[model samples]
Target: MTRTPETPLPSPKECRRLREAQSLSQADVAAALGVTRATVRSWEKGRTTPRGTKRDAYARLLTGAEEVTPHQENPAPALVGAATGPVQASPDRAEPAPEPPSETSSASELAPRPAPELDPDPARGPEPELGSGLSPEAEPLSPSLTPDQAFDALYAFCAPALVRQTYLLTGRRELARESVERAFQLAWHRWPEVAMDRDPAGWVRATAHEFALSPWHRLRPRHRNPEPPPAAPADRALLDVLLQLPPVYRRTLLLYDGVGLDLPETAAETEASTPAAANRLLHAREAVVTRLPELAEPKELHRRLAEVASAERLRAAKPTTVRWGGEQRARHWTRAAIAFTVVLIGATTLTLRTAPDHYEPPLAPGATVYGVPPRVAPGPLSAEELALRAKLKGETVSGPERLVPEAG
Candidate 1:
């Protein structure tokens, strides 16, 4: 008996069942096809069909499944070539299926969906347009200050805290002053990006700590030489010992003992977790105690630290201004202006050299000989010699045409 052909098109129920068997949801299928879940649902419900390119995509998907699972109930038919025999349905089916509609010139049509709406929160503004709205005239609400201004404001706010921290880190009155200045310069450069961050003070403190331990600051002549060490007063001798410690131990000890920063605050400034900072501080305290027996005696170290703290407060309270004006600003602008002028001059020279030359002036007239007789005279010649001269020389000699010889 001749069997009826299996439908080329899958029914909505069959499509849904096939997808479910593969453990794929409508959203998953839609994502794979770069379409919306609604589109996949419509296709499964037979309200709409996947068409043209999408139809080809559907065929590919089915073929992929058949390749992977050859024994699956519904194997895909050969789409490109003619079938050798009639198509058969799975034997478990109770009812016979209808014949597939003949192929048509027009494929199933997919309708375009509306774009998704964005979140309504004001904080969720559109991404900034690059190189746009950055003009000078575009004023920010707060009358946008420069990096220098922002740094100055931050320095003022954090100065007291920073000075105390600086003294703790450097163990020197003069070194701490210099370190804080250097840190402020670095902060001024990054202020545009960092000023609004939640932990700007911590950033400054970290920067100052790094500056204190920098090669330029830490590698003093005393550190390099073992013999003929530099002399210091008793108080400075104590500070010098603190400064001589390894950077990690020094900072850990300073944060806890000198600055009185808690473990968490120290961790925040140093960019370490709290437990790590606490461990470091513990080790540092032990090391300092081991090296300085006086500091190991609790009351003596506390007394020295108190004196240092007092000195730090005095330094912070004094009016100090960083003069970015005068020679420094002049030097910066002078270098810039020199560079600009050099470029301008170079451009002008290039333009002049490449340009065509025109209208060259005539050579100047030779000088006039007003008083001088023409350098040699136009002298007279004898007539006796005229006849002999005429015969020898190629001249038509007239009767007394005196030969006026050319001057030598």
Candidate 2:
């Protein structure tokens, strides 16, 4: 007699656990492999083993292992012929029972066909859930505003602070100004989306900081050169020292100290946590103190504050405008006058082209006309009026009439 090999089966609990670990539903797994839920359940319950390619697929999907052949692990045994009945004696002849279907045969028999090639990484992994689980239909904080209105409000509230922040971050006056302007332009386009957020100003500040640190600006040559250094007064020296710090530390210190924002507000503006902002401020202060020990002393700091106030006042009191030269003003007016004249000429030309082909003089002040004349000025004549008039008058007049004989 010959014995047949029993097929190995998978545990149902293991199948369910693997599916759960990968965050996949039975339906999802079934759909991916083109198999029905019942088929998967039957395999898991050990009622029947997935044979051939299906057995290989099962191993691959569940264990993430390479496909294994059935013959390698379980070879077919030889079969024996039955003994003859009655008195006849016979030798036991052994033969292989139809080499139990090959591994390929089992795979081909699966209801849900296996893929030609299996993927090592499927989209069944766990994902981090970051935002609140509120439905997308939740109400926004404010009614939506048009892009223009949102931009106007944002600019009015944040432009001044943005300008100062940019200067502190970059140390280049022109670059700082340009960065603020560019940030506002971008904000104008994204205003509708941004206006719904809790902190639009924070959004703008982060955008401005990113613009200031863009690759183009980072790769630009610094202002220093080998030329002889320009002489600078003590106050200018102090300002220069303040500008030389790295952008992150400089911005963190200025927003807290100069702008007078609380730690939380500073953190929001810089897009950092309160603790991070505090650490940045502390490091910046320490760096400055180490560099300028005398100014860092408490007593000296107070004295310097008084000096700073006086200098600020002097700067504020200085005249804000300077007169341009007469020649410059003349040139400006000349350009304006030329532009105006060109516009006027264009308007007249367009009117002539589009107007009706008759001439009507404007009514003079205190003049009145009650009735139509025999003929109206030939229906709003245009720029070609003179030539038209000459042609018509020539046609109306008689040819070569003599007036000399009329006196007799």
Predictions: Cα RMSD each: 30.7, 31.8
Over 4 Å off, model 1: 1-153, 218-237, 273-276, 291-303, 312-320, 323-408
Q: How high is each candidate's TM-score? A: 0.38, 0.35
Cα deviation of 19, candidate 2, in Å: 47
TM-score of 2: 0.35
- Candidate 1: the clashing residue pairs are none
- Candidate 2, 1-408: lDDT as tens digits: 111232343577787676666666654454334333444554565443443344545555666453222112111100000001011111121111111223332222112111121121246442111111112232222335544544554454455445544554555556655666666555554555556443455556667778986757655566332222213365455455566766677666655544333344455556665456666766666676676766554224323322322232111010111012223455677899999999999999999999989888899988877696665564666868878777777873675556686555
Best by TM-score: 1
lDDT of each: 0.48, 0.45
Model 2 Cα shift for residue 308 (angstroms)? 8.6
